[model samples]
Target: MSAANLYLERPALTPAAEDLREEVRTFIAEQRDSGALPPPERIGLGFDVDMTQRIADRGWIGLTWPRQYGGQERSALERYVMNEELLAASVPVGAHWVADRQSGPVLLKFGTEEQKRFYLPQIASGNCYFCIGMSEPESGSDLASLKTRADRVAGGWRINGRKIWTTNAHRVHYMIALARTSPAEGARHAGISQLIIDLKAPGVTVTPIISMAGEHDFNEVLLEDVLVPDEALIGTEGNGWNQVSAELAYERSGPERWLSSFRLISELVDVLGADTQPSTQEELGRLISHLLALRQLSLAVAGMIEQGKSPNIEASIVKDLGTKFEQEAVRVARNIASAEDLVGNGRAPRLRALLMHAQQYAPAFTIRGGTNEILRGIIARGIGLR
Candidate 1:
């Protein structure tokens, strides 16, 4: 494909998606009013079991999957609207985020019938949570260099490896892990496979890795000869690299990439009030402009997924730009507010709190999922510049 072909086709939200926006907004408001969800400032990673189940009961968890798997079989555009509303409202969606976002899709595409029947419905029901097992101790962004290995056994495979920076590993019931099943042949990407490992299986250990903000979301998961049935394999053996690459489009292209600090932006606006300075307004306008453009790009990616197209290059571009914008939003918020006044007893205490949280969390925005440097490299290759 030529560089010109890399351009994403414009996507427009349908009327159904527009209606879903209001429905999701109303649900979020009800959750907030009932105190089931935390305030934006206090919503760290936003994981709430009760809240996830509530969303599931509304048939919103697996929005784009087949109805046989308990999904509503809605369009990806509708899922996009629902996701944006939840994140913008700072709803606690972390519990089912990964499963709903990628795992379910992966299973539907590549899993055996038994695997699909066993896992998809549970995931759609919000009773199951999953974490990604791609990052390892020495192989953070260089996933091909990962040393985690799985050896073939009589009835299954015995896995022995440690995964780091795994979000919610301790709280999740299962993990879709990528491990080396065979030695690298000609390329490093070869000889790898994905497995559906039960986190509570014997010899599995999960230890929390607290963040700089003192949050316990990240985890270190160790698999010590953990055995899984042959049915645990996601697809064919020695195809994990391809499977994971395909999944990255889902992982990277989303409203979450840009909306992580939206709470801070909203709070900043509230603090600035009606009679704000021109300079502040200019900065806010610039931020909003970038956000609008990013949203369009992300929506285009969603449309591509709905059409069964893999927009990996576009997804990488979105992630690279979105994360940079999130980090910049934190800086702008900090410059607009005084630290002393922010920490002091003020009318905008919640805004101050959110600003502080954003600052501490800003560094990880570019690092998680994939680093900004890695994303740029992918974009360079995609554009035929590399």
Candidate 2:
């Protein structure tokens, strides 16, 4: 099917799924009230382990996985409600975000029974965390050109390469990395394999890469002669490219894509009183309309995933549009209020902090997960334009 002719039908959430939103909101409120979680403005792009554990105890981590895997066996719509609420509240979900969103599902799809038995429970329980090792210094957007190599050894594979911009690498216990298992034969995607590498291994080093905002969530991971057991291989050798593609669909098309700047909007509303100017109101309304539309698009993708269909093109669309919206939100908020006044005066400390953080973080919104240009190319290809 040509991408231009492709249509993603809108999917409605069940009443039961809609009800899950209130339950999630209540849980978040209780956590905030009990001081278990910081206010949205204070939260950076990192997760709190204790908070993740608390969420796991509620069985919200693996909401759609099997019962034996410590999941609630719920529908994707239900998971969507919970995830959207969490991101909207700016909860610190970074710790288990990768694991719950992608790693667990990947393992379920490709891991051996033993691998599933060992990792799924831990991930669901929030005792284990994971990072993605895809982009390297020389190969950021062009993942097919990654130079990380893993050679077959006696009982395992010895990996040697570096992965840059690895989010949560310093905090995660494991990384699901892609490496070259053999020489490139025809395509650059050939001979690539996915391995579950232990981050605590002898030759594995994670050096923090502070962002322009001075956040320490990203790292440069170096693997030198790091041995991963044969059992750690995910799916088959030479299939990493396909597997990672699937993983990126999950990574790119989520509530986080648009909701990353939600706090700015929330604060904007608070700062702009109910008696604000009509023009400002119109602008805010426009942002809300875009947010609503993008959200429905994202939910449709979630439904596709639940139906066992890969919505790669649709996901790319969401990430592209959603990221543009995020960047636009920052611009609107900046124009609406003076960040300097808010920071200097204690009247809007929370708004000031959120604005400061969002301003610095906005530039990367279009870069991470996938570059905007790359996503547009994928979209064009899907639509038969490329």
Candidate 3:
């Protein structure tokens, strides 16, 4: 409750984590040399099932999970280092990203022993995939205001509602949906529950919601009388609000938040060397400084999670500033391209394509996961300002 709670001590990575970073870099280099993982023309996490399997083959998928669950029992900081390298190079991790980052952790924390045994190994092996089913068409960032209801049925729960902005729902195998299990009562957060729904089951429909970047990564899923067994319920019947808050902490604090536009920035740096105008140098320096600061804050949150602490407020702060930095990076990249004339005459074609894609994707940076407005409110309330 004190302002001092906002202080985030920098995390010192273990030697093992640093070594893991080099190993990941070597893997990336090998993949690129084999022409399997080429530089992407577009941004965001690229999807490649083969690439995911290769990562799993190296025991990198669930790096920090228990060995019994097909993990290496490594440190969270090691996982952090591996992900930083993979994402920085824009590795095709889309296939297993959701399962590894959010769903696997959620299951580990709240699922029954049977559920963990059933899903964790598959996720760690990169054979299974998952997507988030939190946002509703009408609910925006007010998650407690969702209308998706899962009424108690004969064998289990019969779900009937729609979920929007579901990332990779079409390609993934399952979705952990947040639905109203019981009517809202004393508090709106009550009665909410998360249920793992089979995307291939009958009465489940997935429709694409393409982004301005002309990608089919987002989808809207309709659940019509979808019946799932009682075991599908994650955590407790009415404890979904708490579980989702924890899941969002994972979603909002990763390097993905600040590193989304990193490739574009890197491309800009390559196109504009040190001999550029002093004004340009200042702009580039400012952008890089913001990135380093965000990385430190993100590392602090990762360390807290490893220590069995819930740094939800700190996670929100990271996402809030990190996403804004992403948007700014896009603008900076575009401006630098225009000023340097790097995009003219088809010169620096890769940078041109990346800048174009980033511009289209930048607006959604603050919108996804949770809106900046909503995150700021969480930060204010956490600091006792509200």
Estimate the TM-score of every prediction: 0.96, 0.96, 0.98
Which is better, 1 or 3, measured by lDDT?
3
| Candidate 2: Cα lDDT at 258 | 92
The regions of model 3 sitting more than 4 angstroms off are 1-4
Q: How do the residues 87-197 of candidate 2 rate in per-residue lDDT, one tens digit apiece?
A: 888788889999999999999988889999999999999999999999999998889999999999999999999999999998899999999999988898889999999
Which candidate tops lDDT? 3
Q: Pick the candidate with the highest TM-score.
A: 3
Total backbone collisions, model 3: 0
When summed lDDT is taken over every stretch of 10 residues in candidate 1, the lowest stretch is 338-347
Which stretches of model 1 miss by more than 4 angstroms? Answer: 1-5, 339-345
lDDT of 3 by residue, 104-201 (tens): 99999999999999999999999999999999989988889999999998879999999999999999999999999999888999999999999999
The stretch of ten residues in a row with the least summed lDDT in candidate 2 is 336-345
Model 1: which residue pairs collide? none
- lDDT by residue (186-267, candidate 1, tens digit) is 8999999999999999989999999997799999999999999999999989999999988888899999999988888887
Error of 3 at 11 (Å): 1.6
